[model samples]
Target: MIDPKLASAAETFTLQCVINKRPVSVDVPPAKRLLCILREDLHLTGTKRSCDIGRCGACMVLVDGKPVNSCLTMAYQCQGKNITTIEGLAADGALNRVQKCFLEEGGYQCGYCTPGMIVTVTALLNKNPEPSMAEIEEALSGNLCRCTGYGGIIRSVLKAAEQGGRRHAGRHESA
Candidate 1:
């Protein structure tokens, strides 16, 4: 049960983007948020949907290696850009250093916000391999975790940096 006019209008705009090193083209409404496209269309649900107003970083993803709030980004605006979701962080059945550190450090409690936290830390560590405690705090300010009290998460980031995670940070590959 759908309207033909609205469907046609939605089909008018096609978004072409590179996602996790793979080229993808999908027909979408011009005003559709990139979040919906990723979750609904592309089925990349690793990016969580919380606080849809952009106050929460649960929907964070990487655009051209920079962290962006996918909920606030329009699908049409992602044309020809590189988009990386949490699913892209691993390679060859191996978890990246950041993810491993998060696992070992007990960074997650409920695990709802782990994806965004890991993605943000990946971008931060990519830019600053050996980030100070203050730098880590500043980078993670936008993300909110209701569980685990952030102590384990901070330790995970610091531990990843100590393990030389910079090599894997910001490195996106096909999932």
Candidate 2:
């Protein structure tokens, strides 16, 4: 038998984090997943929730400028951190080069995995402005796409890099 007190009430904490480019503070249980925080509380649905145990990269996001599986990351772990979702990749009502390239290259079909794929690629391009095909493959190893095949996605990444990786190559942002 488990202790009733231990399970009766969940402990909560004040989470302070920078989401996208804005400051946000919220109260949540420490064990709660960041995926839920983004999709539910914060209402940033661009980050998808799938395979809650972290098997899928659908809930991937950038934490401190590196890709992280939000599903596996707890709320407390995000405290005082900078998080970037798919929505953050764009600015001023304009699509970022990576995003535009994806569209131009038809990088998605079904589209369930596009957000996570883009987030992961965004981090990679930001870190390495001109990544080779092998490098892109290695960086995206953790991200799985079931539709649209990988041809278009690869082309999109290549095209984004060729386009100067504007959003990615111009500047670097860290948590």
Identify the candidate with maximal lDDT: 1
Error of 1 at 69 (Å): 0.7
lDDT of each: 0.87, 0.87
Model 1, global lDDT: 0.87
Q: Could you give candidate 2's per-residue lDDT for residues 1-175 as a string of tens digits?
A: 9688986687758899999899999988887899999999999998998888877798999999899999999998999999889888777656777788899999999999998999888888888988988999999888889987799999999998887655546577321
Q: On a 0 to 100 scale, what is the lDDT of residue 64 in model 2?
A: 90
RMSD of each: 2.8, 3.1
**TM-score per candidate:** 0.89, 0.89
The residue-by-residue lDDT of candidate 1 on 73-150, one tens digit each, is: 998789899998998877655687889899999999999899999999988887888899999999999999998889
Which ranges in model 2 have alpha carbons more than 4 Å from their true place?
Answer: 1-9, 165-170, 173-175
Predicted structure 1: clash tally: 0
